[model samples]
Target chain A: MAGINEAKYMLGESVRMLKSGKVSNLISVIIMGFSLLVLVIYILVTLNVSIIIEKGMEEMCVYVYLEDGVNNSITEDIREKLLEIESVRRVVFVSKDKALEKFREQLGKNSDILEELGANPLPDAFRIQMKPESNASVAMEKIAQAATGWKGVDDVRYGKKWVEKGEKLVKGFYMTGLALGLIVFLSVIFVISNTVRLSILSRRESVEIMKLVGATNMYIQVPFIIEGAIQGIVSSLLAMALLWGVCSFAGRYLPGLGFFRFEGVIGFIILCAFLGSIGSFVAIRKFLKR
Target chain B: MLVYEIMPGEKRIIAGVYHLSKVLGRHFALQDINFQLANGEFVFLVGPSGAGKSTLLRMMYMDDIPDSGQVIMGAHVSTMMKRRNIPRLRRRIGIVFQDFRLIEDRNVFENVALAMKVAGIGITEIKHEMTNILTRVGLYHKRYEFPGALSGGEQQRVAIARAVANKPAVLLADEPTGNLDPMVTRGILELLFKINSGGTAVLMATHDVELVKSFGQRIIYLQDGKIVKDKEMLFRGNLRESISNSRVDHRAKKFTEHSIGEDYDGKRGR
Candidate 1:
């Protein structure tokens, strides 16, 4: 019963504080929301960039052109051998006629140029898609080298230089993304915690009076912590809402961009709430110790 | 209603200091101080400015621990006390300051109610009890007034109400009436006496010797971080036995002997 009464009083005190410091609280929440919005925007951009990169990686295929007049048995043997490579995900055989047909479709108005040639110039090839996990330059190079040595294989070709350059670019992007994310995360925490500290400092006199009146440290701290958690919830929701607005507005120009899933949104809100409470706890603890 | 561990053979001694000493910088703030406050006893701790009166009172409330010796307030022994238990100890012991120390933002009722709330009392109970506490302090009509809006004396009354709201076993007042006028000082002192009569021991520390001398209550005089006299012990002729320290007892006796012949009629002197 006493515990219940204490909890009631603490909650009431929290509400009273929130009401009394409405302007400051709102300002703090706004600042926090803006910071979180930056983080959300950064995260969304990274997410979309990674998705696009993955799609580009998946489109890269190694084409193994067969020697002239290769027989069906020889083509099957070459296909089986290509499938045996660890990096190879799938192998599809494309005959010369099919290749020429694709070339004509790609040419469109220029199909006459291809038709001018008496015989088909394209060769039957085994197009191998590398597994997404093994699509790095080294793995692509190894697969191409192995296929080039196979029988009935005239040439094995992939955009080896392009693959190497893309891998380096992707690696650099991820490294920069991680470093920037960490800075934004730390700065947001710093700003929020400092806001909590300032709020608590403003009420230092009240805390001292409470201590004098025999209020326990828990009694004094619970209200501030609750207020912090509330701030966190409000700011995070505001950030998410604002980010959604920005994404919607930007979607007109940049289509098919990804947003955080339901679970990620929920997880982020919970994390922010935890961060808020921990900040209050730390700030209040330092004051109380003195 | 928290259980208090009674030191063996001194059940009536609700609070006391035994050979307590505290050093501040190069000087001794308090040295080998010894005194006891019996249950419901209203004792005046009198001294001049910087005589360690506040320091002694602070030790009684466990705000500051003695560098040597011990202060025992019911179950709380300053030397053995845990940091977390300080609040629990404070709940059973009320402390008032000269500045009143009321929360300016809270009204009289809310200010007094804060004490009960900290003790985990329900809002219903606090609302029910605040009226009686305020009435006792003659401020029931000012329950809704903020501390800043009230006069110094009225603010002190509100502070007193908050201090005693928990029905503490001991109330420690440090210059509570110092900021009030003479008429207001008398009123505040009368309120304190009324509270003390309700079975709560009050140890009031003040720098004014003439002001407290007329009260006829037991008075302990501190000078230069030492007890010069203990009136009750002096009259009881057990100053030496009570303090048990020959040096402190000797000084108390010497001082008491020097002033034994002075007329101390409570009304005539004032």
Candidate 2:
């Protein structure tokens, strides 16, 4: 009955209470499954969409073409200046010959058409990649203004409109996901609280006896919180399993559906545990009063 | 050290109720009820069913707060207590009930052990104290038996063991023998008297006026939530011997006598 052993025993007793409340716990877990399912689907959408957006943003780069009859030295100077641009992450020069080869490869089996042409029509250009965090349209305008006024520079091009739209969509998606996630997190806590409340209610006599015998609120609360947390934990795991099954089945027809990593899944599970503990804590607050 | 000697005639009150008042529902249960229990005092609270003895006892243990007034246990004054300190206060006091109130899930030893466990007593010490208390109550052999297997009298013994396990400053018994037969009641009262002799102030609430009168000790009788009488009685012989010669011992002696004689009669008949 020393502090450590008493605490250890109380934790064990809480686990026993959860496991022994077969019908009630099963009902709680099922309710939790539905709640977590809502939460997990939201998390999955947010994670996968964020990954796709990151990949797309990585490809949002600018292409700067050089003037006709521009010499190699000027092209080198141009590349060095392009690197100085704040938004310009990297600059790769593709010569006339390499450009033609790339074009031929893009044409696939129609490369004979390019061979029939008397001279290579491809221009010497620098493929400019912007910084990952660079504003799409703003960076495009800056590079355009800088390159157009420079010697031997012809034009600067980037997919400014689409990239800007994508950024907006990503921001909106995250805001909505965050709001929805908050509501569902609170809902999950409520469910856990109800489950823990019922368990405490069933063991009301024990609580009274414990109070009579000098148990502090913390001592009485540990077991109920444990019961609720177990419910939260099991429910979240169930939601994850269900989500995994759906994703695996969907992955056959929809690519990138199963993009969630282990860390994301672990984070969700930890949140579920939090919801359970908080929920039970809320439920037992009134009972602890004198 | 001279605090007592300076006022040599003053009694050191270990627990007392000062002008205690309680209201249940629309009616006042207890009003201006004043009394003190000094160290080692064995007092009887004799009252009818609705006399608010239970309410007064609950206030003593802080199970219920009084509408007005204070309950003093040792140095603790209930009215001014900080909420966090109630558990510490309860630890200094022990309570026994008419129903035994032993946790059904635990066996006899565990029932007694819980009181000490809540006080964070070590497991070895809990076991040792439990053995001592259970042995004193003649229930050491039933230590592993569940309350369901115990008779009402044996269950009451387990309750007594639990209450006394922590060596509380004050022990409150509210109808502790109400559910037991006369013989068992005599044994329970004797155990209580023995505990009182060990310097634990005992305030027992019962309706058994004859038994209360026989104690020749301080008695407080409540009627309509008011203390009608608070005085000492006079009786013959010692308190412990009175219990030994009470109806319980005579019946038990007769029962043993009948068992031996019946065995001889059976052999002769055979």
Strongest candidate by lDDT: 1
Looking at chain B only, the TM-scores across the models are 0.83, 0.82
Q: What lDDT score is found at residue B66 in candidate 2?
A: 93
B1-270 per-residue lDDT for model 2 (tens digits): 112221212235567798889999998899999998755567899999989999899999888899989887765567676566667666667899999888887789877887776776778888777778988999999999999999999999899888888777678999999999999899999999888766566899998888778767889999999999988532323543433323323222222222233222222110
After superposing candidate 1 on the true structure, give the runs of residues whose Cα lies further than 4 Å from its correct spot. Answer: A101-112, B1-11, B233-270
- Candidate 2 reaches a DockQ of 0.36
Looking at model 1 chain B, report the run of 10 residues with the lowest lDDT sum: B261-270
Model 1: per-residue lDDT, tens digit, A120-204? Answer: 9889988888888985688778877887887899998999889888889999999999999999888888888888888998999
Model 2: per-residue Cα lDDT at residue A245: 89
Interface RMSD of each: 0.8, 1.7
Q: By summed lDDT, which 10 consecutive residues of candidate 2 chain B come out lowest? A: B1-10
Q: Which stretches of candidate 2 lie over 4 Å from their true place?
A: A1-41, A67-69, A95-122, A149-154, A216-286, B1-12, B24-27, B135-138, B148-154, B177-200, B206-219, B234-270
Q: Compared with the real two-chain complex, what DockQ does model 1 have?
A: 0.64
